[model samples]
Target chain A: MDTTQRTEQQRSADRRRRELLEAADRVVLRDGPQASMNAIAAEAGITKPILYRHFGDKGGLYAALAKRHTDALLASLRAALDAPAERRERVEATLDTYLAAIEARPQVYRFLMHPSDGAPGEQGFDVGKHSAPVLRRMGEELAQVIEERLDLGPGTQQLARVWGHGLVGMMHAAGDWWLGERPCSRAELVRSLADLLWGRLAAAGDKVGGPGF
Target chain B: MDTTQRTEQQRSADRRRRELLEAADRVVLRDGPQASMNAIAAEAGITKPILYRHFGDKGGLYAALAKRHTDALLASLRAALDAPAERRERVEATLDTYLAAIEARPQVYRFLMHPSDGAPGEQGFDVGKHSAPVLRRMGEELAQVIEERLDLGPGTQQLARVWGHGLVGMMHAAGDWWLGERPCSRAELVRSLADLLWGRLAAAGDKVGGPGF
Candidate 1:
């Protein structure tokens, strides 16, 4: 094919792939992972053969969907990290970004967090694989802030890991509850979480004599 | 019925109920929630009628199992609160208790954390109902420690809530990851997590400009 034709074909394929991912998210959100491939194709305004031609099978399609979402989320988080702000403001902004992402696509969040082991042929969709790197990045960022503020030891990475896990967990639980019939606002939840984490972090430098000063 | 006969019947019922719950956990872990009622009953060496007699239905059985595990977990947390320790030690002890509980019953942890739409007849269960009170209790306990250590304003309860969520998240994630793969030693994970949280807690107080300083 000529260069222009090849480029046109690539653009067409890219658009179709994006459409499939968006459809996959919608189907999973509405009917969960059990949503049929044919249905997703239908929702994408494409035929089954085209969907199969692009993704090979249901697992491929889902993995592509997950990868797309993960990439988007990671990019957003990375951008949040670089945003100009003070330490406290940066932490809060990062958290708020995370919460909004999870809230915006809860089903995607659910799929990422909870892997169904029984599902046949579903492979390479591990949250930890994607999440761990983001987490490490976050920890490194926080560690820089912590180290600058306090005199931590060589075990700062481990310390950052703990903080990262704790923060992730708080966001996970708050997101889970927010999706339900909970009484709190998302802003309130995030503020409460920031207070909790910042409060503890601020306190870390005060007393090191094993609790009692 | 006479008191003796009634007492005998109740004792047998309670024993049978306990056996069924254990069997249910096994079946759920091995076969997911799709495990049939008859299979569970057979696994327990009891008749399906007896299973129904104890738990009205499969949903009832699942709820009861969750409640029982949650009760045990909450009780353990309560005991940790009573352990004579300093502020940081108490927080660490609470985390240890939680991690132990989740590690002991990874399947229960999965079941509890499963997503739901709050629709009736859905198999998804709510952890917040049972967990919220435990969180409140932990918060109150932590607040007591923080109050004694630092004269931060009346925001101790909120701080505790955030701490409680962070602790629960760490344990939950650790349990989820550790179920199939031994990423880190349980003791190490617990200690790392404790150090992270307690260290942060220690540092956070310095920033608050409290009166106790």
Candidate 2:
């Protein structure tokens, strides 16, 4: 009952949580979005009750997994941004990371986008709920860059937020669509998206008579 | 049977089809995306077999509703486009119709996006599968408009298809996001979205150098 014992117990619990999450990811990837709780528990080599004890339920588990995946994606994007490049190149790099993440783990992405066990009466699939942290980070990053560099106006932050959502949403839909129909190569799709986004952004920047894109 | 009797039976069957689809819509709205065959049949004052008879299975039923809803939306957009005005005005009106339809029946949209009983191990949602007719129409309309009016190159058709998908996907995600987070009024949201769409669109058109907004 001493502090060291308590700390040891907490560490063990955290390790168990990580193990369960890793099992859940494998099950989800293998079974697609409709992977069952029993399957997840089985994959973890644990009972369903133990799985539920660690994570409240399927939704909680999905949310935790979503947070994990979103953070990883954001980290990739950050790394992409870190590479010294032009503004447009940086945006492309970020998008490339986003799309690649979705491509790499589409089942997890779809499960996050629309969990099969979503509450019965909700009208709309709350994409933001599943990935609010990433959305917030994307908005902050874009808004910060626009304000610090572009100087679009007092409304730059709001505009950047709107644009950020638009871009994120675009990628979300485009990624899903591309997963279904490979009308173009991944590189081509990425380039087309980058062109559309960077073209508009640069044009808007020019209209404001601000920094060169 | 006599011709008149056959015609009467056909009319009655059509009526039943419409009734069942309406019931399905109501069930989906009330129960969100987890709407079951039993609930749909109960809503229609029929049995599950009868419900399945009309649409085969849940996926078939979803596909039927998707076609119905997508058709209705395309009709509204066509009407919006028919309004005599500038090109920009027409585009805004069309987008307004699209967003309004989604807002009006977000449950149908969500159900279409992700049926609770999606087939096991399905990789992609295949949104265009459910709405291919609309996508085709939108692409043809935009490409023709660009071709006839703008005199863009032969590649304009492909560009229009890509842009059509991009625009549709953007609205899809943005509409879902707005459903969850009403950061702005519908009018303001529509206007802002139109500005982004039309702004990028007009900029693209100008580079082609054919038409003036």
True contacts kept of 1: 0.17
Can you give the TM-score per candidate against the true fold? 0.66, 0.77
| Residue B50 lDDT in candidate 2 | 88
Write candidate 2's Cα lDDT for A72-159 as tens digits: 7777876785666665676678767877877887776666654442222222223333444455556556545444444334455555
Interface RMSD of each: 11.2, 13.4
Against the hidden true structure, what lDDT does model 1 obtain?
0.59
Worst 10 residues of 1 chain B by lDDT: B115-124
> Could you give candidate 1's per-residue lDDT for residues A44-123 as a string of tens digits?
88779888888876556666776677678767876775566655676678778888887787676766544332233322
| DockQ leader | 1
Write the residue-wise lDDT of candidate 1 on B1-213 in tens digits: 499999998999888788889998887677654466777888888779888888986557767776676667777776785666655676567767777776786656555544222222222322233334344444445445444444345565444445445446555654444554455676776776665554453454222332222
The candidate that achieves the highest TM-score relative to the unseen native structure: 2
